[model samples]
Target: MGFDQYHEPPNELPDEVRTFARMILSLIEEAQAIDWYEQRMAVEKDKEAKAIMRNAQKEEFKHFGMDLEFLLRRKPQWREILQGILFQDGDIVEHGEEAEEAVD
Candidate 1:
């Protein structure tokens, strides 16, 4: 191996960037959950099942891109809160409860 091909270290992300990343990751998880729900609901043979899934999918897509836009816009605090909710280390229920409390 030659020293001519040294690998560069990844850049250190600011707190805002980290938060945005986490938020996007969470949105992805939510989308996956919606997909799972849609699949489960499909087994019921209900006519509205497909419509529900389609709407959920559309909302997921919107949120996914919205999170990206927030990151791009450097809305750090909002991103931080969103990330806190998304990557709650398996404490989604608690995070949601806290979010609700915070809103009040």
Candidate 2:
């Protein structure tokens, strides 16, 4: 019954680190749920079922966002890097490169 999220011994890790690991795991789960719903909706023949899947997928998206935001709020540098890349209209790769450079 050991948790796979912690790379190190859980007892040795601080509470904040443990919480961070939990949030990271939660984020991963939410992303997986979103992907699962996407695949399900793609293959689903019933329109109503597809619509319900879409709705559920949207909820997963929200949860993913919340989890990401929680982690980012704790990591200022990460948030700074993301700020330069997210919601920008320019080239994504270029933005990422610039963001990395700016942070360095």
Candidate 3:
């Protein structure tokens, strides 16, 4: 499709960099799909339509998670930071600050 993901010349980018850019774009698209489905479900009148939208949104959520996991695997520092921040009980901002400090 479009090569809008590349800020620099795509021809100059290594294959890995190009692949990373593609994954980033996929992550963004998945997030946008989730948001669109949320808005659509909110105003939808038909029960069946809302149910379908909800299902589609769940699929988008899974895709988003997969994309995030893939990117995180490529960035160990990011993974380390998120480990301290995700799924733990505490002040979120505090957790984020602690995670950032830990990484640093």
lDDT (10s digit) by residue, model 1, range 16-81? 555656676766676787677667666757668767876776787677677666664675555555
Off by over 4 Å in 2: none
Off by over 4 Å in 1: 1-14, 41-44, 71-104
Q: For each candidate in the order shown, give its overall lDDT on alpha carbons.
A: 0.64, 0.97, 0.96
TM-score of 3: 0.95
Poorest 10 consecutive residues of model 3 by lDDT? Answer: 1-10
**Predicted candidate 2 versus true structure: per-residue lDDT over 1-104, tens digit per residue:** 46989889999999999999999999999999999999999899999999999999999999999999999999999999999999999799999999999999
Model 3, C-alpha of 6: deviation from truth (Å)? 0.8
Off by over 4 Å in 3: none
State the TM-score for model 2: 0.96
Clashing pairs in model 1? Answer: none
Q: Tens digit of lDDT per residue, candidate 3, span 4-101?
A: 88999998899999999999999999999999999999999999999999999999999999999999999999999999999999799999999999
Provide C-alpha RMSD values for all models, in order: 13.3, 0.9, 1.3
Return whichever of 1 and 2 wins on TM-score. 2
lDDT of 3: 0.96
TM-scores of all predicted structures: 0.39, 0.96, 0.95
| Weakest lDDT window of 10 consecutive positions for candidate 2 | 1-10
What's the alpha carbon RMSD for model 1?
13.3
